[model samples]
Target chain A: MLSQENRLSFFLSFASLLGVLLIWQFSTLPQASRSPYGIPDGNAEYQRLMGRSAVASTVRSDFPTPGAFARNAIEVLHAPFHNNGPNDRGIGWQLGASLLRVMIGYGLATLVAVPLGFVFGLQPVIQKALNPFVQILRPISPLAWMPIALYTIRDAELCAIFVIFICSLWPILLNTAFGVASIRREWLNVIRTLEVRWPQRLFFVLLPAAAPTILTGMRIGLGVAWLAIVAAEMLVGSSGIGYFVWNQWNNLSLSNVILAVLLIGLAGMALDAALAFVQRSVRYAE
Target chain B: MTLFPFSRRPYAFRAAPCDHGPALACQCGSTYPGIFTTGHENGLPTGAMSAQASVPAISRRHFLGAATGSAALAGLAGLFAPHAAMADTAPSGVVEKPDLNIGFVPISCSAPLIMATAKGFFQSEGLNVQLRKTAGWALIRDKLLDGSLDASHLLSPMPLALSLGLGGNAAQPIRVATMQNINGQAITLALKHWHKRDPRDWKGMTFAIPFQFSMHNLLLRNYLALHGLDPDKDVSLRVTAPPDMVANLKAGNIDGFLGPEPFNQRAVYEEAGFLHVLSADLWDGHPCCAFGTTASFAEKYPNTYRALQRAMIRAAYFMQEPSNRLEAAHIMAQAAYLNQPEIVIEQSLTGHYADGLGVVRDNPRRSGFSPYPYPSMAVWILSQFSRWGYLKENIPLQETAQRIFMIDEVRKQAAALALPAPEDGQNNWPVLTVMGQRFDAFHPPSYSKG
Candidate 1:
């Protein structure tokens, strides 16, 4: 069912990825040969049981090879939804918790941003006046909000939500502002002559025409939201993909971080794909 | 779940001549009714009685009298056993809250808390404890204050600082149920500092401490002050994480750091730095970390709190056993706990370590376990707080120490009231030897003032 051009592009993309993996494996060969911490003391029990050299093994840098990745992927995917108390849980549950937070945070951001964006776009005076505060806050990293949030909110879970809201707010707000502000003057004049009420004109004319730009902003916000959520969760040791990555870092297991990284990438792609679908439905060819 | 979920009644306490029979009796430390497991009446020897000083000397005769009352109690317990068994925390009045979360940082100082979880000490005490590994001291403080964590392993100085409202928001006073570990911290210097080993020569050098309100900072400042160098003027002290200390040292961002083990040993293990001196050398048995909770939490759930105390104190005893050190360290090194390489952890735990100066050191008391939360130690810590300008106001040192650290009799022997003891548990007041100068709890302010 695939088109010729599409199949050719897919083949080329696969070839490029294969080329990268091959290069990565070769570069990490020297790392795998020696222990990352310069010690061969991994399986201390092997010395006690069998008196073998393998007993005092070292952990390699664990730059994941294609084979290692496949093995780890299988192990991680084998039981994706096992819940073990608070500290430890299945990857499925962790992913779910993170996604749920993002959705809530992003949804909350949208509720605030879209309405405010309309106001900013509708009113030039308010937009110019409030521009400085948004400009300053937009460049600030989400993690910078950690201490302040932890202090004021006084809960790790809420702090995470607050962080996500802060990080994802900017893009949606700006895009919606642009979308609402740049609505065709003719469209408004038509609504005006027809004596259409403010609410109807805003909803029917403004929203539909600006839907594409708003969706584009939301897509960018989604990417930034996922990125910020992980970092925030890492700082706060609450349940999230970020917590998983931080916990792995505590164990000095870069391999586990890679696993989390791959999962985050997949989850991110799925989210983007979902938003893109919505974007397309609202999008017009005009 | 059994008809009676044998929890409120700990394994150390029995209901009726022990279900296994008196022949298989254990020296159950205290006398709770229906738990006739002690082989002899005076089973606790003098050495044991010293520890059991906190445990009331409930006579076997009075205990048996209490036991008869327990049979009646058991009949009542059987009536509600099924309902109780379904609940995580006993709906029964004994343990107000059962399922609890205890937090700890990933460090050797958290060995007891970690062991208590791994060894099922928490469960045996009839408590379902979730041992959450927190990220940092400040996070632990926030979590504890916010009541998200029922209890946490805290840096010894943290509760003191928090109670005094020094570093941040206070009014939510924290209490030390018991000291978790002692003397497990050390000063680690970069290999570059190998030549200028003496403290006097280290002028203008930057050093890191785990936290501003940590014993690591206190001890580092004390050491510098003792050597005639002002900690503020002569050297710089930056707050850094334990794991990050080694990386910072390796990066040459810091010349040295005083932090908890096995990070000190980890630095040596990774060849990033050399162990300059163990904290044990400066103060032979200084309190490091404590198992702590909010004062309100301890007051609210007395039984649950008692069970926690029993587990943590027993685990403290278990940690001090020389034979248990290596095995315990290995357990701690697992990904779930300390998460360091086992061998590196073994070096600090077993007291046989490569000091990173091409010499091996063996000192069994490198990390002593001081389970007792002596008020005197807190007095000394208060003096240091004043010396360092953390304590802005002149609060009564003894009063605050007793209020936070001394653990007054109101809640001390929650389960062992059948036995009798003094109100405050600091009878043989600790005579601490800090840097060849004595710190007698009576006047630690003067000792620190110099």
Candidate 2:
């Protein structure tokens, strides 16, 4: 049922992935045996003392190969809901904790930004008055606020949520304002001549016109929120995917850290796709 | 014909009597006298009493009385069970606040606190404890001051630094209830420096310590100064977290580090570094970490504080036994605790480990668990503070040591548990040897001339 070009593209993607894995595996293979040049007098004891033995040195390599990563990934995913203790939980629980935080933070950002953005769009003077502050704050990185937030909030979980809230606020606010302000003036004039009340005019005419832009803004905000949560969780570690990464790093298990990175990427892509689907639903024909 | 066949024989009369004599017959004796006197006073038939008494045993009157007395007393005890269950009181005092939140970093140094939670020492003392594994020491300090943590595993000198308002936001009086571990740190250098053993040959090399206010820092400085290299001008010191120390070493970002185990062991495990020297070799029996809390928390919950102290002391005692170390390492290596390999923690705890030179050495004093809070140790730490210019003005050393160390409280708690106390005069200022030089606590050497 697929077109020729579509089939070719699929083949190419698969081939590229195979190629990368092949390269990774080959690079990590043990090299040919070489003379122990650094050892003095060709002494076996000296070579062993310096940790230059072939078997001992390769027992735990600096980087894990693709094969090792695959094995570790399967093991981690096999029991994704196990709870060992407060510091250690399965990947499923870690993802669930992170998603919960993102939802609460993103939902709060929407509730505040949509309304205030409407006000900014409707009133040019008000937007101008607040423009300097918004521009100043938006460029600041989210992690920069961590120390101040920790000191003032006095709670680690709340501080992480506060960081997500800060990062997600700006994009949604700006996009909503732009969408509402750019609405066709002819439609507004027609509504006014039809003697429509302000409430009906705002809800029926303005909301529908700005729906797509707002959705786009939400997609961007969600992306930023997801990005900030990992770093925040790493700083204030107890339980989360970020904490799982940190805990493994402390244990010097690089393969597990790589596994977490993959999971985070997959979760981020899923969130963007979900937002994109919602955006399509709100699209209108020109 | 009887519905209950065994009921024909009186169960109380068939029960065994106490072996100890009547005067020392335990709780069972209390009811024995009452039962015997009651029967005699009631004038039970002498014919039956004499027949039973002739069976070559104690009088039937006394035997029956002791059995029935014990059963009645047991029933009474059951009647008052709810009150006993509600309080769960320890022998010392009723715990005012049984639920607690104690914080610790994931290192072998926190073995006492972690073992206490795992071994049920806290529960035995009627305290419900939740151990929070924190990210770093700074967060531990912040959480403790903010009241989120009831107590925490702190650096030995941290309480003194916090009280003096040197490294913290405000001056808060903190109390060191017990010393957690002694001499459990080491200086590990990158493998490139395998041949650079002499400190005099090394200049411009950066070293990482866990914190500026840590004993690692002071000791590293002292070691450097003894080698005739100025720590300030010759070498760069960075304050890095323990978890990052090994990673940084691997990346060639640092030349070496004087950090707590098992990171030093971890570096050797990873083949990124080799153990250059153990902290124990530099200064034997130096204090590394302490079990600490704010003075206000201790005052507000005195009984709970005592209960915490007792639990930690017992845990320390448990760790001192060489037989219990492997078990301690196994429990601590789980995901909820240190989250490390069992062998790595075992190496650090048992003091038998590969030194990364293909050599396995054993020195049992590599890591010690002692609950004594010696005031002289505090004075020594303060003198280091003065020597390093951390103190803007010289404070009264002995007064500060006595105020913060809580030696008297520790002595009293240790005695109550029937543990042997340290010798008399051990708490006073005394001369100690470090790196083959005598350090007189009475007259600390002046570093101002340098």
Candidate 1: regions farther than 4 A off: A1-82, A123-133, A196-203, B1-93, B358-360, B407-428, B445-450
Q: What is the TM-score of each candidate against the true structure?
A: 0.79, 0.84
Clashes of each: 12, 0
Per residue, candidate 1 scores C-alpha lDDT tens digits across A206-254 of 9999999999999999999999989988888568898888777766556
What lDDT is reached at residue B444 by model 1? 68
Clashes of 2: 0
What is residue B96's positional error in candidate 2, in angstroms? 2.2
RMSD of 1: 10.0
* Top model number, TM-score: 2
lDDT of 1 by residue, B268-338 (tens): 76567877777765665678999889889989987787667767765765676567888997898776677
Model 2 Cα lDDT, one tens digit per residue, A1-286: 9999999999999999999999988887765433222312224543443345646333445788888888989998999999866766899999999999999988999999998888888888999999899899887787897888889998888888998899999999999999988889898889989999989998899999999999999999999999999998888857788888888887878899999999999999999999999999999986
When summed lDDT is taken over every stretch of 10 residues in candidate 1 chain A, the lowest stretch is: A46-55
